[model samples]
Target chain A: MTLNTWIDLVYLLAAIGFILALKGLSSPKHARNGNLLGAAAAAVAIGFTFAYPEVRAHTLNLVLTLVAMAIGAAIAVPAARMVKMTAMPQMVAIFNGVGGGAAALISIVVFLLEAPGKPAVYRIAEVLFGVLVGSVSFSGSAIAFAKLQELMTGRPITYPAQQAINAVVGVTIVALAVGTLVTGNVPLLVATAVLSLVLGVIFVLPIGGADVPVLISLLNSFTGLAVAASGFTLNNNLLIIAGTLVGASGILLTRMMSKAMGRSLANVLFSAFGSVVTAAGGADGSAESRPVKAGTPEDIGVLLAYARKVVIIPGYGLAVAQAQHTARELADLLMERGVEVFYAIHPVAGRMPGHMNVLLAEANVPYDELKEMDEANPEMSTADVALVIGANDTVNPAAKNTPGSPIYGMPIINADDAENIVFLKRSMRPGFAGIDNELLFDEKTTLLFGDAKDTLAKLVAAVKDA
Target chain B: MSTGILEFLTIFVLAALVGNEVIGRVPSILHTPLMSGSNAIHGIVLVGAILVMGSASGAMQVTLAFLAVLLATLNIVGGFVVTDRMLEMFKPKPVERAPKASDASGDDATGSPK
Candidate 1:
């Protein structure tokens, strides 16, 4: 049939690949294949897009596009191969930001091209909406990525009149958007674009680190919605379909992460973690003197040896070490030594939800022995030894005492309740959100500094010796 | 070479930024519970696809939207179902080995737990 019709068919197939790839990504086993399928579909769509007479005719822009593509591909490959697992959430945020920026850019380009002479109120409104959503997603996501990756403080930075300032910016964006629409002026449109971008950064500036996972999920959804809106503006079937898919999923994920943290979504976004300031626990003097004691693999193994009741309080540290398998082996050895061994897994442990448990299961730890905080909290009181792995915030007692702390209302592991707490840490550095861990200060706690893998291996040997 | 390159870049960059290896390094210690949690996010992808497709106004858009919705739905629902079933299977079965005063195997001192 016609080339146009053939291109449409190709796009439709690409959309299917998006669907399958997303679905396949649900399970780790199929994620690889699903991703490949989605990639192939995307490739076909791109090739077909070039076949369109209008797109092909722009040769200079076309070459630039190819060059840009090459640069992007080159960067992505090595980074994917080299980046650490801890950085995934941040990476996701950054990626979402780029998609949003692209969508916003696309919408603007289309509006300018199609309405070179003039446009109606509705077109202006749609264009403005596109710019606002896209800019917000892009800027907000970049900040979020920064927060998660520790490039910036995870805590909120606010002033007495920050909300008012945010409101002023918000109003400015809307006014500019509406003005650009009614006036049909290019410069005004440009102004609105800048305003929208600034507004996004300001919007997320006051957000604390604890809420980032939710934000990631939410931003992911934003990127999708932005794409869909752009698709609508351009009347593209695939963009609309794919964008909606991403947006809807992101919203759902935000809700789930909110629930996992035992907080509502609104509480996470609008409210500043203003309460963490008044908490009893602080990074203050008492916490400072209580040095974060570090030990070697040899020291921890020695403690595990012949201990009556050894408890493993794994946090994000355990997740990061990818040491669950080794930890499990250590436990098995302890168990063989006539030492009671159990895992105290906190509810909100690791970078994302269920991070610790996922890591442990990879090592094949028995599900039954893994204790929830409510159940495990009490166990820490009497255990001979408490192995505090890469976890920080969840185990912190500050969560309970400091209402001013960002994570004040969140529940934590009472690892401080244990007989002796051994912290398996990499360094004295603070956690993802940069909050000081007060649990490290307890007289009962001792720091064992090393990678989770190395420490667990040492423990395995020590337990064997006993 | 040109158009799809942007989209591909999006996916790979997304993977890298999110600690591509994090999920891959799922420690056995956290498996069942972690799966249960991430499963919920996966479900979101389904909802997203549905909403996108549902709002569309044409045959091709509709078809594409439908494909996304169906797949997302299956991904989430199937994941949760598998997790529940696995949880059930993993539920500490009645132990044939008689209990001793100190079953140091980290066995439930509190008895079979949910």
Candidate 2:
């Protein structure tokens, strides 16, 4: 077979490997295998590409490519191993963003190579689209990483005429894209990329922290589309297949995340939810005006030890405190005392869907005991104790009771229904969305104030004494 | 080239539909890992980066392609490594008394809760 034929076969095999990887990832039993399959596929693809006659002819390029891959591996391996479970979302965002950056760069280089000769308008359009989407994904993901890392405020950064400015920027980018296609202007292309980057920042800036996971998912899809565009510019079949798959899967995941929050994708992006509050009338005034029961670790320990059943609710605060293992220790102690223990996980808990589960799993928590909201709510009212561990908004009754509240209509765990409720909190601070939790003021609720890990340690000690 | 772009569009659309169905059945518990896994796949853009880098004729094009290769490699390496790390955590525990891997190490340093 000719060298091109060999390359084609390798690409075909690599595409199949990616498909198998995706299929395997959907199930826990096969997830590790899926990841390995992807890695092997990548190795094979890179190897075959290196052996291509054109690539082999470029000796300097070959050395640089190999060195780049090595450097990338050197940086990535340690970083991946060292990152805390809580920071996984941020890490994913950064890694995915770099891919988008690479795609944008690829578009620029390809455009420069083709533009001097008056390349076909369709080809120019494809290159422009790649640059546009790739730039947006890169910049948008940076904002997301900043938000997740708390390097910037998690609340939506909104100003006057925010959406209007974004709209104008959007129109300008489209115009520049068309101009580049018509005139084949490199400067216009560069301007389009820079403006698209600005557009990404603008696109994500007004979105509140609560909706960031959806945004991340959406940006991930954008990167996939960008990669696919690059694939078209190169006329590479494997890039088209793999990039499109990722793009599609990302869109689906974004939709699922939106559904889990009981919001539409448009609403999540444009809601400006954190900045606005609604005035609502209710029997329980506001969270600040109402009083709450306060308790110590000793009181909590006694309540938990004597309870017939306890359901634990975890949120981002738990992840922030790095307290998953401590929480699990407390639960194991309760279980040893013959008290039934199960975790009640809110769908939108932590930074993303299934985030709490991943953290808990890392702590060796049994998979069967971690229950979703729907499954856990029915058992909550019957449970003797509801342990709210560094979690607030998900348990708030306002989601169900007050239609005017920001998080109203969002599904939440019915933690308030338990006969007794105890909250481990740092203070009276609201959650990421900055909405005061109505659950804090419930008559049966007892606030145990402290850092999550420290408070959990205290509970474990107190439980032993009890 | 226009015909190539048209053919590319067809592939793009069909692959997207196929992708949607492929991931449609994933349960919520696996979503985080699944997202990370697919995120790694986008690293396939490294192929384009290499192609651009290898074929460029001038210094400017070479520099751009070099940056593309560097960044795409980062995406590929970091994406896959991080994804594998996460997926490793999701492995099903052996039914029989499986030895605690991470938690056991946590225990030796901090000891048990009691």
Candidate 3:
């Protein structure tokens, strides 16, 4: 077979491989094999590309490609191996950003190589789109990684006219894009890329940390679109197919994430851009002045030991304190006493969807015991004791009770409906959304103040003694 | 080339529809791995990098192509490996080891679980 035919065949196989990978990824049982298939496809694609006649003709470039692959593996292997599960989101952000940056660079190089006024308008447009979207994904993802890693404050950082400033930057990028196409100015193209990167950073700065999962998915979509545009420039079929697949899925994921948060995509992206309006719950002086029922480890232990049914609510703070095992141990203790135990997990409980489930899974929590928000809410009413571990916003009553509250539309675990509520928290501070949990001040709720791990250990000991 | 572009457009639209349908049914539990998994798919841009590198005519073009190849490789390799690691953890253990009566004894051994 001719070299071109071989490349085409390999691309076809790779496309099929990726499709099966996604299908397999949908279920845990097949996820590992799906990943392996993708890796094998990538290997085939990369290996065949090296055997192409064009590549063979340029020995120096071939060496460079090999060296580049080596460097990539050198960094990727160790980073992926060593990163903690808690930091997985940031890892995804950085890796996805590099993919975007790569696409942008390819567009720049293509534009630089094109002879002046020789390319078709459609080709120029594709390159322009590729550079713009790719640059945005790169810098936007960098900012996201920084926020999630706590390199900077997780709160939304805004200033007066932040959106106005961003709008101006957006307009400048569009103008530069047009200029690059009309005049075939390489410098203008470079300037457009730089401006787009700045725009990406500005775009993400005002989105508070709580909404980062949505932002990451959004940026993932942008990178996918950018790759498709890059494929258009290169006239590659498999690239177009794979890229568009990612683009579509990423978009759907982003929308789902926002819906889960009970916020519109528009509001999540822009509402926090201007003056950060303190939510009504945060501003109301009621939460502070309300008499809070505080409980010690022994009190919580006694309550849990006597309860017939206990529901555990786990959240981001549980992951932050790395207390999944301790929480599980306490649950085990309850189960030994013949008290039923179930874990209630909110869809958007942790940094990412299903984040709490993964943490609980690592602790060997039984799959049957982990309940989705819808499944767990009904049981909350029947549960004799609701043990909340480092979770606030998801269980807050304001989501259903206060119309003026920012989180009013969000679906929460019905912890308030339970007979007794015990919250293991570090302090009276609000959750990621900067709003106090009104449930903390409820008459039935008792706060157990300490680190989640320490408090859970104490609770375990208390339950054992009781 | 125009015919090629049209064919590409057709494939792009079809793939997008397929992506939306396939991903719509994915359970929330696998969303993170799915995101990272698809993140690897776009790394197919490495093909473009290879083509660019092959035809690179100058020092500058070569440098840009090299970086593109490097970044794309990172996305592909890092994305797939990390996803596999995550999915592996999701697998159920052979036995749900009930929290032992001496659970505290194992605390030091499993210290820093992350």
Candidate 4:
């Protein structure tokens, strides 16, 4: 197969664009643009690929492709629109899995076509990779998706015989792949596919849900390499380049995700820990958090009107209820009353670090108004009213002293030290770490049992009325 | 030389290993910012996949390339949109204008300073 200089140049430009996008995405400020630049490059690459003589022959398949494309676009567009940002990792995994399946299928079809007898060893390598990586990526990703979506529990499904059986299957698959290489026995190829498929499922089965993102990213990298190997088999430059990029990027992303979660990638993959799904019926467990007796919205308004200072502590509950806007409104009301209003943000308050910041920033909370835990904790002791909105563990007193807890020894804001505490939580349920919060039971604390968004809305209305 | 490919492999492996270490140090406090920041890399992945697809031959290459492009696009676009929505969470409001001391029953029946 001959390669054209123009096509190579276009591919090189796309590669440069990818590099730029990756570098730009290192920070939030440039993330959006990074996406656009990368996307534009991809568009160029796609257009060039279709210019090839081989693919242009499918002139009539255009109509079927268009119809299918439209159907996919409609479903994907809405799903992409509706899915919360938190679930983006899972979505990426599902899509990556599909890519892997496609790469594997490509090689299978190419092998079936009967290649001219040359580069026998290289062909063998490609076939082994296409079968192994593609199969694992496909099934492993599907299981990861299931765990993320709660279709399967987040806990590791540990079976004593599991790893042993996987080893046996893994060896068998390798043997078949090698066998097919030596003598293109279709039976060996089929066996290789089946073994790989099962290996994919088993590989991801023990990966706990909490670590699904890492697995997804890693699998994604596998998909890229699979495609790259397939590209070599097909003797396509664009395929090799693009596959290399995806493979490389996926590997990098997986590492980054693992770091963010404070676990090693190896730990995530090999350990049968991390997935701790407490029952959901406990969703309303905040019943014990009954706010200083159920005070009417108007009563809270009365307190806010008289308060000399009111500080709001925002948490994942705040993010979950999507109440940042209303909280800001309440803050404005407090400010107008000659009350000093500040937002106390904990590092790990929401699902991820800086989660609260992103949410608050979205609500246009001034960077100065948001106080870090160290900054906020000192103020809470003196504040007249500490309005805790949907925060749990970061404000929990246990983390400060309990070394046995998962979040033990982690620094937390001293919301319990405040003059008068008002906790706005739906119930007394524990946070993601699956541990109870003693702060909810504090004597000075007022547990307002309701959705953070609704309760905050009521508070805003009452403040306005007052 | 085959050594060039080996060098590239080394760099790739190093990036992945280093990236993992860096992300592990990320406290949950940095979760949102971290994802937003790293998603830029995910975009790069998408672009890389697209470039690959453009040169890929056979039906399978076509499919993998397109699929990678689509998913990565969704991640980039969706990530930004969601971040915008989340910002709505912290918008400031008007200051509290009234001052009243209400009791436990929540019934503020008394009319105070107008």
**What's the lDDT for all of these models?**
0.61, 0.84, 0.85, 0.61
Residue-level lDDT of model 1, residues A1-466, one tens digit each, is: 9998997788778766766665554554554455556556655665676666654454544453444445544554454335454554555465456656666665666565545668767656656766678778888988988887778877776666777788898888778777787788877887988888888888787777767767766766676666666655655566666666656544555666676566788878876734444322333454455555666666667777867998887777776666766776677667766789899877557766655655555455777778877788777778888887788887777678865666766777777777788888888776655577877766777887788878776776665565
The candidate with the higher TM-score, 1 or 3, is 3
Model 3 DockQ reads 0.65
lDDT of 2 at A132: 94
- For candidate 2, the lDDT comes to 0.84
Clashing pairs in 2: none
What C-alpha RMSD does candidate 1 show over the true interface residues after superposing them? 13.8
**lDDT of candidate 2 over A1-466, digit per residue (tens):** 9888989899989998998999898887888899899989988998788766666667887788778878887888788889987788889998888889999999999899988899888789889989999999999999999998889977777776776788899999989998998999999999999999999898888777777888888888889999998998899999989999999988998888888888888878876733443422221335565677899899889999999999999988898888888887788778777899999998878887888888787777878888999899999889999999887778878889977665677788998889999999998877776677777877888999988999998998898789
Query: Taking the tens digit of each residue's C-alpha lDDT, what string does model 4 give over A1-466?
Result: 3546676678668656755555444444454565566557766765675555544455433333334345544555576567665565566566566667666655655565544353365566676687678778888888988887778766566666776787899888878888887887666776798789899998888765545656766776787677666666665544565566556655666666565444567766876533233222224556554554555667777777688878888887887787877787677667766789899887656654565776676555667788877788778878888888887766777767654444445567788777777888887666654466766666776667799878877887787688
Model 4 CAPRI quality: incorrect
Worst 10 residues of 1 chain A by lDDT: A273-282
lDDT of 1 at A355: 53
Off by over 4 Å in 1: A27-33, A273-286, A290-303, A307-309, A318-329, A338-348, A354-384, A414-420, A426-430, A434-438, A449-458, B1-114
All models, DockQ values? 0.04, 0.56, 0.65, 0.13
TM-score of 4: 0.71
- The true-versus-predicted C-alpha distance at residue A56 of model 4, in Å, is 1.4
lDDT of 3 by residue, A335-429 (tens): 87889999999987888887787887887777988999989988888999898998988898887987655566778999999999999999887
Error of 2 at A171 (Å): 1.1
Best model number under DockQ: 3
On the 0 to 100 scale, the lDDT of residue A68 in model 4 is 35
TM-scores of the candidates are 0.73, 0.93, 0.93, 0.71
